[model samples]
Target: MSTTDSAPTCPVHDFNHYAELPYGEKIEFYDRLRDEAPLIRNEFANGHYIVTRYEDILSVYQNAKTFSSSAVTVFNPNPTFKWIPEMLDGDEHRQWRKQLGPLFSPKAVEGLEQKVRERAIEVIESIAVRGSCDFMADFANQYPSFIFLDLMGLPFEDLDTFLHWEDEILHVSGEPEETARRRTAATIAVTEYFRTVIDARRAEPRDDLISKAIEFEIDGEPVTQDDLESFCILMFMAGLDTVSATLGSTFYHLATHPEDRRAIVDDPELIPSAIEEILRAFAIVIPSRKAMADTEIAGCPVKAGDMISLPLNAATRDEAVFDDAKEVQLDRSPNNHIAFGAGPHRCLGSHLARRELRIALEEWHRLIPDYRLASKSAPTEAGGQLGPSGNIFLEWDV
Candidate 1:
């Protein structure tokens, strides 16, 4: 199997293990590992291990105490940035989730579907007449930005600027130095922007997530400014990216697979199930947690400070759970997929994301029921959480 890198000592399970690979190869590699080395460790970077089997992955996720997320300097635990609930654990994680969860609760998202559908329609209309367009750029990427901005009470007019900042943070644009430079700058700019917003909400609160965050408390005291901004940044990046990539992959699949596309278009009611299948088959999240204490994953010895990767992308396709594990069955029921992840940190935006995807598929296929890859090459896919790296272009009758 071709690894993400050729470093002589790089283990096959390295993040780079799936790096540079196309969509199919990434799956083949994951399957190879799940079947052969379900619990594999790599010494790449600061050294990390991947738990691939469904049960084993669950074991790791469920035992968050043993597998800490605070090591992620992403927002929480960093010197300056505070990542909020994601970087917290135990009661701390629970408290943050409690304060933040209501915004994404099913009831809340239900009220927002009208807005979601309208946004989806607006995005689709922009491309419907063209007959051919870069679906990811025209629809997928832009669609989520609107919802996220609306949630944050940020200006819709700034979607392009936000997406641009988002791209730099989630993706690599050049050499390690260049990528690092751009990412750092993007973080500073977005953080400063949030800092201004946070202060505004403190003075004159609004019905936005930011205002709610400003009012949030832990242990009877309002959350610290750094903590609030950290949570917001985490939410900002998380909100901006996941659904877009999922849309890109789901659209790619439906576009190429007429049978599946037809199943959704014909049934319409089956769109949710289709979304689940697409999520399972094209799962995108690949989060890594540091081992908080000495633990055993399926009996594999793990020491404290070790980085343990909980690749839900691999687990969703485990043969032990779903039949025809690799195939995208639109009607795949009792689906029980972890595309949104599991345990305490399951995706906070899942309810909103689910509605967005279902609405997107229903709306798009309703218009363009038939389309295919514009070129012989399959659209590029990356195994990381942020989704595919490049544009997934599609062409159809105008």
Candidate 2:
């Protein structure tokens, strides 16, 4: 019952390889790490601290000054892309966050909800009749991609290109050189594509976030093209992958757990609670923060420039906070889980994400209430942003 455990004696080599492990195995491994080695030093390919305990992770996330987010990689030191807004820490981070804040507020997102719901329905209806479909490709991936495009006012024709680019940046299964090349190509493509969109928005203003960005001035100066493009790219990748993964994970959990499905379906009013519970349980995103200066977190010494991976998933499921930590109770009250994250770096798109989840659950249950996973096809093992990327095939009676 002690949370102040020392680093593990057993050297954890190839920590990055944990990303490739099966979902169930990964969960088990994380549980063990949280219980035994709260501050384990991951000397795998990348040397970093693997923070597993809930208190430790929360402490790191809250102290933005101490734990910076401006590092190359959020999780590890080696990063393929250069520093963007999400990577910034301190006042620079605050400035960038201010620029992007109003763009995802409840008012802003509420204005976009109609479009999002329409897009969600369109994607959902396309495959609902088949009674058997690749949920990831057809719905999970499609829904968020379309929403992001609409938010940025990008051409719908570019959805496939965006998907491919996201896959490349996120999925690193191939050779190191090849993965790096693919990531570079994706970055260039995304930057160029958004740059064009920004130009178009400037020439002919429209009622969209990109257009607003063009008009928006920080300190009486128009937002720079580089900043706009970077913001757009961040919005696209961040909005799409996290929501899609959450949707997929939600479906995966409900489909497998008939009792949970029945509980939600029976009351329907509990859908919102169900969404929160699912997010709490399947808390994806192993967000990282850097130590801006020497600090002690949960009594563990951390130095400046050290990369710290806060396993949000492990923290949400921490036994210290939640009763029956492993169980997924739809009625779990006063749930303060940090699935979207915490402090100044909390996800700005949370309201939108919640809307999507609520709409998705409502519509999905209405369309296919009795769906169950297929026995033939295996679950997706694709990691990265959308963990378990394989098609979540479900069989239902039409």
Candidate 3:
């Protein structure tokens, strides 16, 4: 239902400035904005809509015809990459899902469960004897990196270079244009590297998924290298940063909140539910969509080209939706948050992400459960995909 005159007026102003605050304080700012209005207007970052309410976000998400994902990022007005599945709309997106769906599908992710658990355990063992380590660097980052390696059959030696690119692309600072330039450079470097991989895979195909994709065809014709490159780049962007960010935030939560950590430590079975609650509470990704046609969001008139900030990070905190919205309750039933997003582009790696999170926390607690935030430096929010701190330092008893 399109809202006309007599609809609610937006009361939010100057709220996007919270990006300058600490990540937790920033989340608080979002909650306050949600209390004021469901749909607020932000004039910064090339002007966009700041959505906080749970239902309002869902309404926009489900009605894809009115809202398009072409404008996927709010920070970069001129984005560098056209991410697959997420950026494509209507029939175009559906068609890609058909061909690429199995790669991230539940069955495929399920088959990789042992690998995820093994990697989680391996990461924990590597750091358990350190007595202290930057959780994000030593464990959180590498766990997902290894899993992505298994999925794409990328070489482990190149992990450092890829991680550097991921950080440079996401941890933007200083002026917007400079940040964009840095981000673009990183994207270009990563794209060129993937081209080399494609070339190698084509000449000497292996048993890995990347090799299979190299020889793949869409419709009756052979798929273009450009198609293969775009798909690989999208996987890196979507796969690497998101899981790492979520794992960082979840660890942050557990370290700071002892009882929340104890809830899982005491009852191992609760780890799965705990992971879901953590994902909802500390949603790392905040994807945006452009208004396809002039549409009304929560009764506010949204102009075409006006970008809508779908802060899935704030969806679970809607008081009307989740009881004790801000508090971390692991056993909360009917926990239906859009941390993975909604509609067609909902996170492709949600299953893998969940598996990785659950296995990580469970295995870590089994080995080294008691830990706290270390390194006076706090985690700062970054890029649209992963916004907790890229570097979260933690110390613990050996």
How close is every model to the real structure, measured as TM-score?
0.91, 0.91, 0.92
What's the C-alpha lDDT at position 106 in model 2?
Answer: 85
Pairs with steric clashes in candidate 1: 4-16, 75-82, 75-83, 76-83
Candidate 3, residues 185-286, lDDT tens digits: the string is: 998998899999999988898777678777666666676787778778888876668888788888888888898888888999999888888878777677
lDDT of each: 0.75, 0.73, 0.77
Tell me, by TM-score, which candidate is best: 3
Assess candidate 1 and give its lDDT: 0.75
lDDT of 2 by residue, 226-246 (tens): 778877777777856888888
How many residue pairs clash (N, CA or C atoms closer than 3 angstroms) in each of the candidate models, in the order given?
4, 2, 0
- Give candidate 1's TM-score: 0.91
**Model 3 per-residue lDDT at 96:** 74
Q: Global lDDT for candidate 2?
A: 0.73
**Tens digits of per-residue lDDT for model 1 on 212-266?**
8888779888889988888888988888788888888787777778887778778
1 against 3, candidate with superior lDDT:
3
Specify the highest-lDDT model's number: 3
What does candidate 3 score in Cα RMSD to the true structure?
Answer: 3.0
Better model by TM-score: candidate 2 vs candidate 3: 3
